[model samples]
Target: MTGFDPAAHLSEKLLERIRARAAAHDRENTFPAQDLADLKDAGYLAILVPTDLGGAGLGLAEASVLQQRLAGAAPATALAINMHLVWTGVAKVLADRGIADLRFVQEGAAAGEVFAFGISEAGNDLVLFGSDTDAAAQPDGAYAFTGTKIFTSLAPVWTWIGLHGLDTTSPDASKLVYAFVPRSEEDDGRVVTRDDWDTLGMRGTQSRTTELHAAIAPADRVVRRIDPGPSPDPIVFGIFSVFEVLLASVYTGIARRALDLAVQTAAQRRSKKTGKAYSQDPDIRWRIAGMALAYDPLPAELASISRDVDGRADHGTRWFSLLSGVKHRAVTMAKRVVDDAILVAGGSSYFSSSELGRLYRDVLAGQFHPSDPESAHATVASAWLGPIEP
Candidate 1:
């Protein structure tokens, strides 16, 4: 693993192709189907699966680096693929911990099957700990889900959706059920995807709303059923750790791209007063330096935490805070960098066609993801100050 480079898997030529299509996909508000095809061909979907399972057998640290590279080219494409990677990463986590419940996920990813994360629900702030959807248990032990999931990334082409719901009627009344349901025509009217993904940015994700009408997850697909509220279940840890690290990696990549753009713009643009490039201006130099100062530590932090996850290093109860804190810092830093990059580029970046303009919009979506600003603060506060008295 010493000399492993993400570039070997995600080549520069492939990234350029993905980068070239990004603007068109953003402008048209369409899914990056070709990007998905290329990534699948590159074996990126199975990067976390074991080598014996027909995958690259890379660890989480390597996957984080690769995701950062992907995001630098196309944020929306990288974000959409993040969902698929999440499932595979979680599978790796479980397998590493001697739990094989999600082995199917790894196998499916190795076979080029796309898995969409379906945990998000409108107005449900409980996240992984709770769910608004109904998990009606059938006599055969299969559970039928009935609810709507928002921001279902890769919605147009997801082969299986990994989701959770509350099982209120089962003997274990308040258990939270985690399961995976296949996306197939034979589902009857169980699963419906709304083509309503037009957004401010990250439009290429096509993260549409999904309505589930008794979408059935067979018994084998029901991976976990844990009590409501915080639990030490491996599934919870697996999802949270993988999701946050990959998310941070994406935003960090965005910041890296923004900083690079700023440097390029500063070097190319001439200053009216000095008749020299803006890169020579004191103010411009300071601004780019500030952006660099902010961007410098993110990759190191991502690598450290991702390696901890891969190596199964124990962090006790500090895991949540660490994960949320990195995501919070990465997104905020990316927004800052993109904002400064636009300032460095001047009015040229204000136009819709500008890459900075797209980056500006794409970066804004970071705040909307889980472990958002408020949640991150709370998690950190709880970890440091201990939970408030009931």
Candidate 2:
């Protein structure tokens, strides 16, 4: 419970190494394998697991801080790592609530097994509340999932994928099945990862499409079977809370980096009119100050909510709204800051080689993650005014 220091987990040296490779990975449209390797060596994948389980035993708050630092250096690396952390974070949440179904997730991560999130689907607006994938139940209480998942981050090296599908035939009929399936070639083509991750930004994430053809999760891996659409299941809460908060942390980190770059650019660039650093220019000073103003509140906000989650504060039904709201704000603020940074950095930022230009592209990815703008507003609106009338 002492003051948490992100540097202890992600050293400046390691981060600099990761940062140095970011543009190359982005340009090549490839995964940050060395970054992942370095993180694994640092035991970052197990940061959320309890110390008794051979991890750093940090809470979501600490993990959030660490993610921010990591993202500041190499956003795509931090983002891909977020998927692995999500499962471990969920395991911590479940363990905190006395649900040990996912204890193996904690243990697996500590042992170097990489877990990827696979919940997102194409055209499935219901999100965590619904699934387009089919979850056919087996007599032994296992389930076979069949569908395609888009934006499956860590697609290249994940050892296990945590995903969900709809169960329509079980007597529990119409329940959403949350399960984990290993990434094994022994499945004879049941699990397929598509090598198609070309995108405008966050290219190092290599988040590609995945096809599951009757991908089986043995009984032990079947974590939850809950009714779809806004249930009170701990799994739902754990996923929603951790996912949203970590996502916010990532974009907030992006904002922090953008603001820092703007400061550096302002300090280094000379204004022709005054022969002084742009940092002293009235307009440049105003823009940098404005960027800082926008960026200031994000870390505090992320810390407060993340601590609430770690402390298990009873936000009650307001949880969804609070989580989504922070994520939405962080992303929008990051985009604004990056845009202003581009202006302050002037024409140099327009080139693809500019770090600001790379950041400009990377920051755009924030809007596409879960609890998207429309959904975030809807969740908050429902918390305040209730659902729309049918």
Candidate 3:
């Protein structure tokens, strides 16, 4: 519940494994098998678990720090791990009332199985907007979830799923609660992911779409009722902040790799006009410096918000709104920074051979997650006054 310093808690042995896997994992677009195994063995997947339980009981601040460091090298691995951790994090949010399947997710986190969220929909620009999809309650103590869910990352690699859906009949949107379910079913595939993730970005993420068209058994449903109307204000806004922080970490890591690779490869890049090290060229130096200018100062700024969020201190109209502003700023800055890295790294940055290229693609995907800058900014502004619509 307290006194957890994620900066200090990170295991060097585990990091070495993540670093070791960074190349081949990204290259082959293979699963981050080692990183996931290491994280599970380390028991970090139980992060944010209730203090009453035997968990470390850490806060978002600690988790964010770990994510920033571990993910920067291998985002695919970091993100795959996050699928479980975020599910763990959100499960705790709903824990007060008791989500029956939660204990399963908790034990799974400890035992090495992971649960992923199924929210995105097909044809949606930014995920988290909820699908045009809808659900209905049935007589069998279950609901027939018969809509498509897009961008369900880690689907191929997970054991359980946490999903959010809409019940058109609800009176309030906040009532649209999140639920937990299994990835497999002898009855039918309660959850299924489409194989549409083959792309130029986040190759290994396996972020594909899914269709839920089976009986969501009663005891299996985490939270089945809702009063669909307006959105869950501070919670929605706060989730945005959480996502932005993670997205920024992904890009920052990519940019850091860009700089590192550029510096290392500079020596071999000779001038076309003259035989000279590219590292010594002023233009090349300036280009790389620009990336540095953008890369630094992001984490501390995100960290700064922790002081406000933890204390619920002075800020915008609501605690979450205040974080939204910071999230937007961090994401926007990361976008530009990586663009600069891409430009400086040259044509190579566009090829899979170059790590920066993959980094660039994954970072680009961050811009579209949950919501984009435009929607995020609008949401923050609306929050200054009150909750947002749509």
Candidate 1 local lDDT, residue 231: 91
**lDDT tens per residue, model 3, 140-194:** 5455566777667676777766666666654444345456656665237665666
Task: Please give the distance, in angstroms, between residue 91's alpha carbon in candidate 1 and its true position after superposition.
Answer: 0.4
Residues 1-390 of candidate 1: C-alpha lDDT, one tens digit per residue:
599987889999999999999999999999999999999999999999999999999999999999999999999999999999999999999999999999999999999999999999999999999999999999998999999999999999999999999999866467999999998722597999998998999999999999999999999999999998999999999999999999999999999999999999999999778899999999999999999999999999999999999999999999999999999999999999999999999999999999999999999999999999999999999999999899
Tens digit per residue, CA lDDT, model 2, 10-107: 99999999999999999999999999999999999999999999999999999999999999999999999999999999999989988998999999
- On lDDT, the leading prediction is 1
For each candidate, what is the lDDT? 0.95, 0.93, 0.63
- In candidate 2, stretches whose alpha carbon ends up further than 4 angstroms from where it belongs are 185-187
State the number of backbone clashes in model 1.
Answer: 0
Q: Each prediction's Cα RMSD?
A: 0.9, 1.0, 4.1
